[model samples]
Target chain A: MIEVENIEDQNGLRPDGRRALELRQIRVKMGVFGQADGSAYIEQGNTKILVTVYGPHQPRGSTGRSTSNITKGIVNCQYSMAVFSLSSGERKRKPRGDRKSQERSLQLKHAMEAIIHLEIYPRSQIDIYVEALQVDGSEYCASVNAATLALIDAGIPIKNYAIGCTVTLINNPSLEDEDNALGKGVLDANYVEECTPGVTLSVVALPNNDSTSKDGLIVVAQGAGQRLHLSQFESLKARVLYGCQDIRTILDYAVREYLTEQSLPSLFHVALN
Target chain B: MEEYPPIIVRLAINRIDLNLIKNENVQPRIYTPGEEISSQPDFLRGHGTYVDDENTLRASVAGVLEKVNKLISIRPLKARYQGEIGDVIVGRITEVQQKRWKVDTNSKLDSVLLLSSVNLPGGELRRRSAEDEQTMRRYLQEGDLICAEVQSTFVDGSLSLHTRVLKYGKLSQGIMLKVSPALIKRKKTHFHNLESGASLILGNNGYIWIGANKQDSDRSEGGFTQDLSRIPQINREVCARLRNCILILAQCNIQLTDTSVTYAYEESMKYKINELLEPEIMIDVSLLTHQRLIQQ
Candidate 1:
């Protein structure tokens, strides 16, 4: 693992020179691959993830779950990382079917299931396959964001965008020396800070249509590393929630731009009338 | 053998605007998922919409809002084909079942081509028997492509297809191009024999078939028997050109009608057939075709 010490220099900036709550630059391209029903590629900081959505179509062949329902559909998700994704002059032997990838896959399904209206496509199954081409930090966050774009491109009906963001507590000696308030939390942690010996919380949030909940609706939240003090949980959750809302706005804008680019004059006329 | 042109790839910058042909005032209102469309109790929710906890009807997919009377729906720009009755489709056999063959028409579910709905090797009125069920694989095995019409729809939403007509049957020696189903305009006829010596079937499900022109006199065997004979080079070129033409129009989001396709092909004659794959040439051809359509 890379060195985790001195995450923030004396200037009160993270090693990447980002402020405490600054998110990495995000670039997204939808319908990147023509073969899939819907596909997207998202790059957040140094992490890049590609996602392809196959179907809300009939489940093919006979299987353990052969009984097609009349009311709801099934969500099948697969998460795989490229062999060269986590390179430190070393290669990964297996890309998928490992314990870590399987767990992430389950987490993604839960996030996706929350927003997708499964009842609309009864007796069908929607397959979401995500590949991490590059993994710096917050792999799961990038995966969820990429998958959401893929679902949007596929035109799958969803209640909301399932946005993911990770927040980590800064334990760097420089930050603690500066002031007590600096230790509260840091938003959108990179790989080194995530691997540090403090609490790192991963959150999957859905920005509510209304402002009733300040933190939006948290679909999934999991903490890694050392145990966190009960007092810090609320602030960390709020920070991550705000990060998710920011991401949702970016994604929404990208989707609208894509729609306008693809629409023809006749389609515009049809919509206008 | 004729020499082929090398493929050239390039980027397009400041190209034609897709909305160039329309009136300036026709800017479609766009909607995103979870965006509220209406909170009124009188408006009924339709496909691509669901009522949230507060009884607000919200869009489920990002696209444009469509309303018919009191029913409001959002039509996404791209999605899996939603099958409708009377739609002409080209599909590949995915499975051979007891008395039906499962066809993949890019729909929500695999469509069914029942034995009773098909014209047997003998004739259209031939009665299907248990022997026919046993020989189903021989008639239409897995991976065999066919053209058919949607006879009806099942309760589960899967399409029930028929090939009783002479024109609809096992397809051979053609190239299949898939595109977004929204681009294919539903018309009185989906089949077209272009003046350029190629036959095309623009499946409503977005699976297009371009084949060598076949004569009506060769309609024996209920259009089942495969014509393994070689397709002339000129006819093959025509099919290839038509395939590229449909793709270019689709890439530009132009409506895929027979007229648009023929116009695109006519405009593309200045460039080599292989050159049509180039990005700039494709835009040029589609743009010219769009101009012609607008002038009409």
Candidate 2:
């Protein structure tokens, strides 16, 4: 097991023979459901995410955690795992009420709230549920990205877009931990590279803003080890910004295709019928 | 920046990865927005849209425009949940466990039907026997459309259902339509079956059972279109009719409710009230269910 660590040496060649910044093939399907306002399923690298959107309807449960602006909508999020959605033999179907899912749900809610224009539909709710059927690495990132697409599919408005990605530093023994987090970074680490013992940073970014909003710069800027220097943190943040930009580009393409396919329902009947 | 080989090239060269290559990557304008996408036929959704300086790229549909520099796309999905706290969804029994029947809501997850929640025959609310108490498979077999309620949601995302209401039991007659689970919008309550003909309830979890109700009237009188005697049998011709009804509703995007039966589902004789009916409606009546709807 230890030998599998650092499968991608300093040569920057991934175990799968890809580059540091390269993403695995993404297969996206839009409007897979006939009943959802907007829904999407995306397979990124080894991770798979299915996002469904509900609402812009009268709110349920207690209100006022959000305000009375009738123009925007309240976005409710549920991040879950299917009972049969285990990826590898080593992985168990994540327990439904687990803390990770709960925490991730709140984190996603906070991050998405910043992007979506919630003031438009007061007393109403827009539910965006993301189910990770297969988790490899960057599962959080996959959920955020998929939810964004589903939100777009649902036609929800956003002030600006939010995208998430993760970076893992392989920890060069010779080089100090301080120096590595700076630029010797791995962009979008996969399961194998991610498992390498080192500092991992999860970031959610708004690509187009040039990051004008203070908190808007990174929706999430959490690092998994004790601490890192501010400058090194800045480097990691910068890398995420680039990932966000790259993701924005991909998302843009996907939305265009979805819109194009949606205008004609005939094609669906022809194919599925 | 760390230098690396072109991963896209490696992917492009790998015949195996080609299977995973998105349709949009293979073609463009054909995959452009407005539902007439000629390429990447299965492109799904991307992100933002791009317009040239001239503002030519327009999103023709009513969805969010996802563009990448100059690329554009859109796909629509439903967003409303109309069911109330205690609304009943008449679903087909799809799976059966020891004590529960799982029904598909036409939503993302299957709704549940607790055996205890159901009112057994002879008015006994208590468990009858291990064999008598519950063979379960005998009481509510699979493929039955039983009416149930949203008692609660399971931690794993499944809906808990109950059959406490007298009216919301197993279904009978009329053909069945099986569409994507999400189309069945949960409503405040759908209580009436307007067709006037005997209808039964069967849950989709395959637990609820249904029989025909067309017997007492048209079948006995021979005034209606379909022969009554043959209606009891679930044979090739009957199967065809059932399949036809399902296919029609699924194809036309029609919503069916208790009071919402139209010509395609049945004939004018079956409906006691005269109303303007739409083109694509049909009735689904099964045995064990038809008579139950009538006496009530």
- True-contact fraction per candidate equals 0.66, 0.09
Candidate 2, which CAPRI tier?
incorrect
- What residue pairs clash in candidate 1, if any at all? none
- Candidate 2 C-alpha lDDT tens digits along B1-296: 99554333334234231111122322223222222222333333343222322333323233433444434553233332223347556676887877787775653345677777776655545555566436677667788656677677654345678777555565555555444323343445444332433342322321211234532232221111233454544343333443443344433333333422333345333422112122212222221122233345
Worst 10 residues of 2 chain B by lDDT: B17-26
What would you estimate as the lDDT of candidate 2? 0.54
Q: Pick the candidate with the highest lDDT.
A: 1
**lDDT tens digits, residue span A33-93, model 2:** 7567778898888789999988555453465344555455567889997765655545555
Give the per-residue lDDT digits (tens) of candidate 1, residues B18-75.
3343345555788999888988888989889999877999999988988899989998
**Least lDDT summed over 10 consecutive residues: which range in candidate 2 chain A?**
A264-273
lDDT of each: 0.83, 0.54
Q: For candidate 1, write residues A65-181 as lDDT tens digits.
A: 577465788889999999999835467789999998998999999889888988778788899999999888888998998998999899999988888898887665555443543
TM-score for chain A as predicted in candidate 1 = 0.91
Kindly report which residue stretches of model 2 are placed more than 4 angstroms away from their true locations once superposed: A4-10, A60-72, A83-88, A91-94, A175-183, A209-215, A219-223, A265-273, B1-296
